[model samples]
Target: MSQTATILVIDDEPQIRKFLRISLSSQGYKVLEAATAGEGLSQAALNKPDLVVLDLGLPDMDGQQALAELREWSQVPVLVLSVRAGEADKVLALDGGANDYVTKPFGIQEFLARLRALLRQAPAGEAAPALVQVGQLRIDLALRRVSLGDAEVALTRKEYAVLAQLARHPGRVITQQQLLKDVWGPSHVDDSHYLRIVVAHLRQKLADEPAAPRYIVTEAGVGYRLMG
Candidate 1:
């Protein structure tokens, strides 16, 4: 079934679109291409590809706007491709709706690995696990609620998603890019500030000390790990 999944590639650069089309096709995925955001949206609505590789800078529309539009109508996984390395850009894209973000000049192997991970986690078939517990925090995915000890904690939608991803993989060092992509969607992977802000918020809510956290530990220039 995985072998038959269709991946839509949206980019203004012919080179990128061609490269991804060939690479994805070589990996046994059916590939579709679009040169503009408008075209991408049209194809997405019609074909309903299993996943989308969207470039942030498009001719017809900015990638972020495209992502927002897509999210309104579809739950299809989106992986954002951009040259912008700013943390703010990453956070904005993720906050908007991208599932993952990859910077320009990315290593092919790493990109493929990230794509595989996102696809593996995409909502499909069975119902996702709803209840996740880490230390004193209890997350009820179904109810979109979190509680630490005797107090209820509040989180933004993206915050909950980030925590959920970490809680799902306790003790794992989830990369900043991965967390950004997973929580904010793909477009925000490069926006590390979103991750920082959200992590800070999570630590404030769940950790014994926000400065020196027990549950969420930063690896410093690497990523974050949720200690079990």
Candidate 2:
């Protein structure tokens, strides 16, 4: 997929943009760059890149604002980069609409891994599978049915929503905010406890232990990822 993929890099620092352009280009990805938020937005609308690499500190606008604006019209995957390492900053960005967050001064390999994970969730000119199999679980998205082995596992509406979201992006981390916004509503993004309660119920029904999860893997303060 990298061979024909396009990635947009929005960062003010010349060195940062240059480094990303080189790194992403070397991986057979077409790289588009913008030094300002406005330019990035324009590029994103016009070119419609597969993924975006955004920096929080921008000359024209705050990266979070840019992200919110982007989310309004587009569902493109966005991987945010910031100098701030605080958990709050990460949570805010995730809730604001970022697909993933990576701290500054990050390793190129790890960055590439995160980028690939986000790309995997992007539409690839085909519809997602109707049936997703993960270990002992089977999810039939079209019918909104979930089964473990031969027995059907009944789930609440919210529980099914969360599981389906995770199932769709198996192995990719879905932020609490993203899940809340997608499942509950935008106003409920900050209500992490609502998600926690739902997840607890799901774990109980799925027979998944929080100590060593076999399906839903918690990312602590970040979010959750479904592991097959």
Top-lDDT candidate index: 2
TM-score of each: 0.55, 0.55
Q: Which runs in model 1 stand beyond 4 Å of their true positions?
A: 125-228
Q: Best TM-score goes to which candidate?
A: 2
Q: Provide the overall lDDT of each model, using Cα atoms, as 2-decimal numbers.
A: 0.80, 0.88
The per-residue C-alpha lDDT of model 1 at residue 110 equals: 92
What C-alpha RMSD separates each model from the true structure? Answer: 12.7, 13.4
User: What is the C-alpha local distance difference test score of candidate 2?
Assistant: 0.88
Q: Over the stretch 140-160, how does candidate 1's per-residue lDDT look in tens digits?
A: 643446898878888887777
| Predicted candidate 2 versus true structure: per-residue lDDT over 1-228, tens digit per residue | 556789999999999999998998898999999999988987886777889999999988999889876774567899999998899989999999899999998999999999999998886663344567878988776456899889999999899989988887788999999999998999999999999999999999989999989889999899999895
